[model samples]
Target: MQNRRLFLGSVAATAAVAGLSACTSMGGFSLTEAVRRLLQLSANRAFDRLLQPEGFWDDQVTRLALPDMVGNGRGDVLARILTGPMFKDRLAHAFNRTAARAARNAAPAVAEAVRGIGIRNALALLHGRPDEATTYLRGEMAGRLIDVMLPEFGDALHTASDPLIGEVMAALTGVNTAALANDLAVKADDAIWRAIGQEEAAIRADPRSTNDPVLIGALSVR
Candidate 1:
């Protein structure tokens, strides 16, 4: 990915002479090509940024409280109380720890999903919101992303929290194992996307800083 990023920097250097602008292109750059870098850059930076230990644990926006303990955003107050502070702390710690690992492990999945999303109206997206690429990605595979990472996220959660997870899950009756895992997966994926979107916005705001030709050419357009 670092090599590809450097290659893109070289590509940007030749932007003015690379190609002719067209309906489907941005500032003489193929919208397809530009979108590819835009998405790739965003996904790569996002995952790399969040892959650190502080990624989820420290980020106020992406932190996973599992605050609900079971039905976060699903409204399960009983689940929260039943889980208690010790359980909540353990689960949150475990979730955050595994979330960081998942961010790294799920990079390919993110890249594959980004590659699979065919940008139909390329120009529209190019001129859309700063995080438009990320919005498009969220719509395309947010759910699918959860599906792809769930198994791995679940496995990591088990490995990270093990005995505590076993004890908690065994004691927390009425809490479906699958649902809890799904919640963890959803939280992790959401955090990743949020981080990715932020990176996309940052690049769009200052494309020149990225030193990537495609983004510079594409976003520089009015």
Candidate 2:
């Protein structure tokens, strides 16, 4: 009896709070299946929230910083000027808003990727950390997402920002919109993945927060 109790305690202590794994069976609440569901739930919830109006801009967790061409507020005179009240309009519409809008198109790719995730060693990953699933997704899609969305985002950025803004950015950064887009793509990916991680953490802490059976089953103990 004592040995059984100790084994159960150890298993409970080491079980991952939440995660995903590779499999397709709809059987009982095995750890592997639960992990996979948590992953998909986190990804879908994060993306859905981001697809809303001003979703990226209003949510600090997912809001992206200004494009590299725009410069930070400290040393660069142009960057400082752009940070002033006069340029708030340009900055707001050009970056975060654009990212929020772009998420609509980018989401389909992300969803497809999420669906394709087949974590062959779900047992190992599920035992690591609550965010292991999100980390996996980021590694799998970060660069590919940047590549897939760059043109779309570049076009959106060009459309959102005025011609004068682009000219000023080019003058300061010596990079065209296409070049600037690479940096933006990276930032956007970081923000989105961060949002996914946040959702995973939230669900892990309180499975009831999501009302998803898989997430609740996977993480309720934690």
Candidate 3:
């Protein structure tokens, strides 16, 4: 799952180039188009990675593990248990297995929704503020994602067969969902600035990239 996020980030970065090109040609780009392109790029990369043998299982980053209860300041309950014998490995393995399965199940819907984002909101997003664009996409699709993914994750958890493992998975799911949401918020802000900063820097550096719609739109914001 971590790997999935990483892969998504990378793809978004890559997509920025294509988006810039598209925006340049279009005279003005839509934030929706930018995000849709990001999603499309990310999904393609994720699908490629997942098709690999070690895709979800062998990748250390994607391979799930117990939440770091210590650094995260959760409490001693998890620490005490982790320090104890027997259950630690079991707990870790169970969570990873569940997360891997959930990623597999959730991939399709995510891809579909991302594509939908391309078609539905790309134009509107391009015209909106950075945070507004992010909020729009999240509001439009988060509930749909939760509805689709939660059930799949729940099913995967149910099949785990270990009661303790299930408990850990439940905890992990809650943690991951919150983390993902927070991360997206940060990414949205970062992406906004990145888009603006990069464009400004390019204009200063090359002078030819000036007058582009993306740059114009961003500059118009404030």
Local distance difference test scores for all models = 0.72, 0.68, 0.46
TM-score of every candidate: 0.76, 0.75, 0.41
For each of the candidates, give the backbone clash count. Answer: 1, 3, 7
Give the alpha carbon lDDT tens digit for every residue of 1-222 in model 2: 999999998775554332222222223455655666777788788988888778887788887776645664233556555767756555655577667766776777777877677676655655557688789877877577677667767786565455645545544554566767787777778888888888888777787877666556555443
* Model 2 stretches astray by more than 4 angstroms: 1-30, 72-93, 160-173, 220-222
Model 1 lDDT tens row, 1-222: 999999998786555333424533344457777887888898888877788877788788788876355534232444653456775776677678777876666788778877777888776787788788888978887477777767866685455356655555554556666767787888887888888888888888899998876678777765
How far off is residue 106 in model 2, in Å? 2.2
Using lDDT as the measure, name the better of candidate 1 and candidate 3: 1
List where candidate 3 sits over 4 angstroms from the true fold. Answer: 1-35, 47-81, 118-136, 162-222
Model 1 clash pairs?
12-213
On a 0 to 100 scale, what is the lDDT of residue 80 in model 3?
51
Off by over 4 Å in 1: 1-20, 23-29, 67-87, 156-161
Error of 1 at 197 (Å): 0.7
lDDT of 2: 0.68
Over 144-220, each residue of candidate 3 has an lDDT whose tens digit, in order, gives 54444444444545554767655554444335644442333332223222333333233334323444454444333
Ranking by TM-score: 1, 2, 3
Best by lDDT: 1
* Model 3 C-alpha lDDT versus the unseen true structure: 0.46
- How good is model 3 by TM-score? 0.41
Q: What RMSD does each model have against the real structure? A: 9.4, 4.8, 14.2
lDDT of 1 at 45: 85
